[model samples]
Target: MEISLEKPIQQEVSVTNTGDLSEIQRVLTELLYVPDDKLKLVVVLELLDYFKEKFSQKDYKINFFYTKQNGNITGFVVSQIDKEYRSYGMKCPTFGWLTSKDFLSCKLLMGECEDFVRKHKFRKIRGPINFPKISGGIGYQTEGFEAPMLNGVAFNEPSSKVLEYLQELGYKKDAKYSCVEVVESNWNKGNNLDDDIVLKFLHPHEIRELRSQILTLAQNSFYSVLADAPGGQSRFEEMMDSYDLVFGNRFVIKDNFDPRSISSIPEFIEAWESCDLNKIVPCCPLAYDRTNGELVGIIMALPNLFQLWSKEPLTHLNVDTVIINKEYAGRGIFSSLQNVGQITSRLHGFEYVEGTTIYANNDRAISTIFPHSTPLRTHYVVQKRILRK
Candidate 1:
């Protein structure tokens, strides 16, 4: 008599581990049904190479999980005990997987993950997450499949089985956040930016020249949010690599109210990274303080190419990271940046703008951010504690 919850079959689900890039890509191809060209396999390979370059010698751990049924592979999950999780003794190696269509396979794979977690002596498994929380939505989608998959979200409602399995296994919501959609016609683009602040859009041709200032502003601008978190330096490194990829496409604001402000075009271009006058502007924006001459805030975004996976192409944008200086918190800088990224996206032919992981207790986002657009779905990153005996 078979005792496993997984259905009785000639071939039982088992675990095999590998860190081979080709195997990983093969698994991804089996999981994500998209054209090879549109999928940009090279970008993913580049990301893997980047991490390999950074942590090849470190005590980084990676384990891949899969379930094969009747001589065919059906489900897969990749588990990594990387620096982000190891930092500060937070043992949260993330799990990235395609939709687990079979409940039994999902259950078995998760059991293996839990066992892997136990073996590592880490309590509290938090995952089924994408790499780098800033660009990724930080959680799986709980609703909103009618809308097409955007570039930055975790899932598009197909992973309901995994969500169910996590819940059944006692994983509770660590937090819930929503992505609010801002329509171009409904936006008040002229209202949010302060009169004292002059916003500039970075142009593509200026990327190589302004690398240093961009790095400086990026480090200072996000200090409040990222300070003291795990693997902070590695995160900065990731940003540096990613910055060059989207170098000219950015939004920057400088305070014109100060007399010392380098408000002129040449100086502005020299002092900052992302403004150009010749063409349609880019979406990511950085906010600067003229009076104090410091990096005050920033709004970051990236284009979603998931539409390429669909039968019909669609346009989408993800407003991934928005940070306001600790001192500038109440001045509407965050919300303004959100709108600026969204409206800029909308104007540039993007049909929708979305972001997520706004804390449930975030009163500002609840009151100010939610009211600005229609809420499409609830987002969550599920977690469970594993205590040492």
Candidate 2:
């Protein structure tokens, strides 16, 4: 299949299924700024190989388009179509996992995608998804391009002009996403928290208890968070696991007067004799009702840091979550918890603090911790019509 566009040179493009992996990879590497050693490319190749095998069964179809100049390959676009979800599937055949840096060549590739979808009787096209859902699915619409191009998410760094051209050709913004950054020093200095709420290091036993609660809270929060940000939960867990490899301690704040001291290693050991060697510290916040002596609120902090755009590691105290019963709202429990996180982060050598929030959340967090920090990135929920009918 081939298409030509009328331009200064009258470029002719050919779309084909050559089953040529190396040739495809060569053009792709040239068009995209993918680093030679990034593991994302390895994952991409694996996905492609899996697709190739599946297409052999005739359950899936693969398409490729190349812009050739005198038979030398200038660029290519690859896409796949699956027939499993006929009802909800796009009107045009959906094709994605596309990458190209060459301006005009990339445009031609997209045009070819539209042509393929039209020829196949597809109503619309959507993708770059690693594989169709009928197969072992391996992507999230929100997963790619969450970080900078250098950080290794698939399909990052497409040229803006190319995107604009696609939009002009009838694609629209389907999603918006963001990456927020907060300098530790910029965190709110107002520690005007309730005096009864106490901030303390956790004992080994206490750490274990908090860890159990954290797991529960994280799991419960995942669905609600995903309603607004589809892939945040999985990514959050992966990030936390990575952090656990670096800092094993669990930190918390409490209302108890007798806070555990870091020097009391023996006492900690006695309390958690069966604890894994990996578990070291417990840092959390606790709030108590003076009369009832009941644990009213708990907040946990774990070390989380990100490599900045400057390539410098910015260490910050990250609040995984703060749990307070609904009855405790507006009683300053949340404020106290965040204060503990801020103070503890500074003491622990962190230079920044950051967390994600959904649009529906109250803006109190922003006003309290980051009045001026720019919302570094904004995420969106994007949609496109599948072109193959």
Candidate 3:
């Protein structure tokens, strides 16, 4: 590796393998706020261990870059090529590295990453895809200071100079999604809710009965939001599987929702039960209108306890999905269902709820959730072609 700043200095820039795990940890610790004692760091180490076990004997390449002047280290970047998906079923060729606050070194690091991918014969790239969304993405570009950086999404508080420099280097806006925080203090306490819409906390037995109904709602509403990405159905299935299907303790199902009517519920439940629930904590779901003796809508909440390294625990809640029947849309039933879910979150000690929506969602979620909240984070999905044959 050659190191050169504008106006060209004679200092040698060298690229090396991340031979010292401690050094890597140190660099990342300086960049991110994750505690050394947290399970998140252990999870990251476990992921690296998995990569080593799977790819160490293969043709995979992992390297790091360091800039030194007069034998003093000032900056570094880590890069690795994985032959298999680490997690979340993503199989793209990926690179992860760190760069100093130096502008030229950052540019050089990104160029080296692109070159490495092209040399390895990859056609496209998708990342800074971190192990979990909570660990910020590698390729994040920050624009303004008006908003705080979102936990879990890709982010960096680069100076305005760095932003202009990165744009001149060829990265562009990829995908934009908002992360909103709904504090417990913001709950709609004064608005009178409908008496007929009853909220029930589901147990394992009721979960078994309503499991099929929940899956029906997930699959029906699937294509409406996730139709564009690669293997969207598989990704959705994997997410559902993470909750152990219907085993999440924090799940809400509408009353008397018929599971038999939907075809995918049985299989989902069967798959969910086969996993070890001990590794995953059960989330509470708020099932609405069960007392009305009819099934209408189901809202499920998955507590993201494991990703606490990204944000404070109980400060954020990832709304797994809110499924409402098409016939129940115009009657304000969805609002009622959401109210129950939010209130349940407050009772359980959660401060905010977050979820994703595609370009086609027609502002249904935004109109309902954003008016009373602050934006926490934003994510962009960018793609680029490798100029190789």
- Winner by TM-score: 1
In each prediction, how many residue pairs overlap at the backbone (N, C-alpha, C within less than 3 A)? 7, 54, 18
Question: Backbone clash tally for model 3?
Answer: 18
For candidate 3, write residues 156-247 as lDDT tens digits.
Answer: 44442443444566655454555566543333431334454443445445554565566556545543443122223333333454445324
Q: Quote the positional error of residue 194 for candidate 3 in Å.
A: 14
Model 1 TM-score is 0.71
- Listed in order, each prediction's TM-score against the native is 0.71, 0.48, 0.56
Alpha carbon lDDT at 124, candidate 3: 59
**Overall local distance difference test of candidate 1:** 0.56
- Candidate 3 accuracy as TM-score: 0.56
Instruction: Report lDDT (CA) for all predictions.
Output: 0.56, 0.45, 0.48
lDDT of 2 by residue, 270-307 (tens): 32333322343333545555556555666555443223
Query: Which 10 consecutive residues of model 3 have the lowest summed lDDT?
Result: 263-272
Ranking 2 against 3 by TM-score, winner: 3
Best by lDDT: 1
